[model samples]
Target: MSEDAIQAAARALSAGRLVILPTETVYGLAADAGNPEAVAAIFEAKGRPRFNPLIAHVATAAAAERLAVFDDAARALAQAFWPGPLTIVAPARADGGVCDLARAGLDSVAVRVPGHPVARAVLAAFAGPVVAPSANRSGRPSPTTFADALEETGPSAAAALDGGPCDVGVESTVVSVLDGRIALLRPGAVTRDQIEALVGPLPADQDGAGEGHRSPGRLTLHYAPEAPVRINAQGASDGEILLGFGPGVGDPRWTLSATGDLREAATNLFRLLREADREHPVGIAVSPVPMLELGEAINDRLRRAAGFVG
Candidate 1:
């Protein structure tokens, strides 16, 4: 919340430079959305596929409205989840003020109003849209800390806004509305059930894997870690160590929240991943947990970190 830091970040964005900014979910590499050249810098910096697109970060609902055409459904979702981890993809009006390239050449632009004070401050000062995605090299783990981003993105970033750790520690839930239907492209803090409760039953596959279905976050091989890690329940071999969610039965490499609570597990997942990387084990295994509940997101991250198919 430093005014100096906010001013420095605003200047970077206006000058067509990349700035690492924090959000509720993860740190993002931000560039001016109205400038195609600035937006292109993000793609080049991350090596991100142009087809994948980027999210436009805004300071308020008014700012977001200037970027895309929002229907009633899109407005409902925004009102309920704005300033949090949610991105709604709707058709970009021909007169939409954002750059078309920022939407990956699609008719819609992904937009969100971040909850972090520093991020909000930057957006307000810039007084325009900021196109951003996870602040890491393409296909690497999303950075939760400024130090980690510096390691990957390097000093090319004009400034890095240190917002401490991301609370959600993942990407936003992306809901796309096209052709008069609601689709969920990716799932995160917002669940399908929650969306359904408000909007009726949503399409099972929002990314369109099959007929009338669209897939979100279904991309194979994502959310990876720098080190070898695993999920195990009992003790481990000489090289392999235990990441215990319960009492450590014997010699161990690391034990996390031995009480085994899912909420605790989610909060500790990245920290443990970092610790495991530092230990540099050949592999780190997690104890198996039920997949129907909190275990779902936990396993999602672990599988992503381990580079295993989820």
Candidate 2:
């Protein structure tokens, strides 16, 4: 942490003020999790719905234990993904001591230990839980940089942690362990296959599709760009195209990139989206990416960007 960042975070948490902090996924609008007023300020700042809830960020597993009661499964997942992009929903341990508003009236609360040094620094300095989520308006793209946070949450949001660019550039994978079996509430940096390998086969949702109270990212029409987007097949002709995992044989207006490499595509996805959004074409078209390790998350974002379809 920079000296300025530590000072700013300390001051803000001390004063019960909200601060925008960086994480492995994206910057988050952070406030004292123990302070209801400060946590309320975060909702006001981000225009986030009280129904959506916020994730409490702690510096260490010991720190997280204070916020929620973890079972053995929860503990294992925490051990595997702490200091990384994964949030587990477990029963809150406060017994009404901590603010229930941060948990959205739910018995369980979402919590994680972010992989960013600045985030850890702030948590370490405050020596308390910080409730935060992506530092953007409720349904907008999550900001991966301090500049983007400033744009979304305004300049006076205290300090913006300069932790360079985010590695994942998306929200954390969320799993709910309050129930008997491990259930994936959201797909993110941690894939479903990875989870299955660790545990047994994931409990199948009998509803056949994940939605409503079941899964988080199952919401249609999410992670959308400001403009319309389209998806095209490989080597297929599309108007004003942006190839996701291959070369473009058409006009220069169509941006071209590789389809096989998920990491390269993930790194460039948002930047390309921003560029295409600025170009303001009738519609932005993306070619299909190959299905692989990180490809699931990449394709999920792409599907959302392209209005949840091909």
Candidate 3:
């Protein structure tokens, strides 16, 4: 991407306007984290619930430390996973620049140091924290390509930066470390094994409708496609569009990973869903994916897309 595009986007955020930004995970509708009006624009544009909160993206982990108070575990995870698909949720500093709306009126904040070159360039140029939620309309499939992003909510943005297709097709893995304990809030490109290896065992996160304010990806019916979805599907039901895993699992055009690679499957998940939804099929069916490694993150998105998450 050109420096001009990045600078234009940076300027828009500085002016409390919206910008559509590319990240390693997916396209995001970004705003200045310190600007409540800009942050409110994101909710209005995406039709996202105010209580869902948003993640503050920074250029570096050191920059992130200025806003969120990270304990030992949070710091270790940040060191190991920053510049990649991992978000650390922790206690907010008294002077953290993130606005109350971005934190959903909570005392905690979710922050990520994205790995995408274009996103990093914009963050560095902006020289401040910005909150970026998925660019698509709330509860819709996330946009993996610039075209899809523009189609979803581009009109609401003052500027946009295209970084081609996202390397990690899913959002960041989110973990919260508070009061000397750790819990997994959301699963994404970062696998559990990778985090557990660095931070030891993690406990299950306890949350309900009232607690949705603590995280963005906790809702059960998020990431939905236009058509209904059936998981562990043996084959496409009559008129159903099939998305299968592994070689020869189903039509090659709809396959997640022809070689059975979980990483490839994760990268293709959202794109396939978007493609299938366009065909106006009776429904979407997905073959059973093993709950291993990146599979957990893949299944997490699938379950949410199918409205089975809780």
lDDT of 1 by residue, 1-310 (tens): 7899899999989999999998877788899988988888888898877767778889998778887788888888888888888888777777766787777677677888989888999999999889778888776667777677777675658888888887777677778876678876776666667777777887655443331112223345565565566654555656765667755543344555567666566656655666666777766666775464456556666666666645
Error of 1 at 253 (Å): 7.5
In model 2, the worst 10-residue window by lDDT is 206-215
lDDT of 3 by residue, 1-310 (tens): 8888888999999999999999999999999999999999999999999988899999999899999998888888988888899998889998999999999989999999999999999999999999999999999989999999999999999998889999989988888888786777787878777878898876554342233357787678888899999998999989999998987998999999999999899889989999999999999999999989888888888888899773
lDDT of 2: 0.71
Residue 65 alpha-carbon offset, candidate 1, angstroms: 2.1
Every model's TM-score: 0.86, 0.86, 0.97
lDDT of each: 0.73, 0.71, 0.89
Better of 1 and 2 by lDDT: 1
By TM-score, how accurate is candidate 2? 0.86
> Using lDDT as the measure, which candidate wins?
3
Ranking by TM-score: 3, 2, 1
lDDT of 2 by residue, 1-310 (tens): 6677687777887698878888888788888887888888887886666776778889998878888888888888888888898888777885624577787777777888988888898888888888877777766667776677788885647766777777787778777776566777666777777877776676554121332242234435555567776665544334354545655433444443443556666656665666666666656667766656667676777776666532
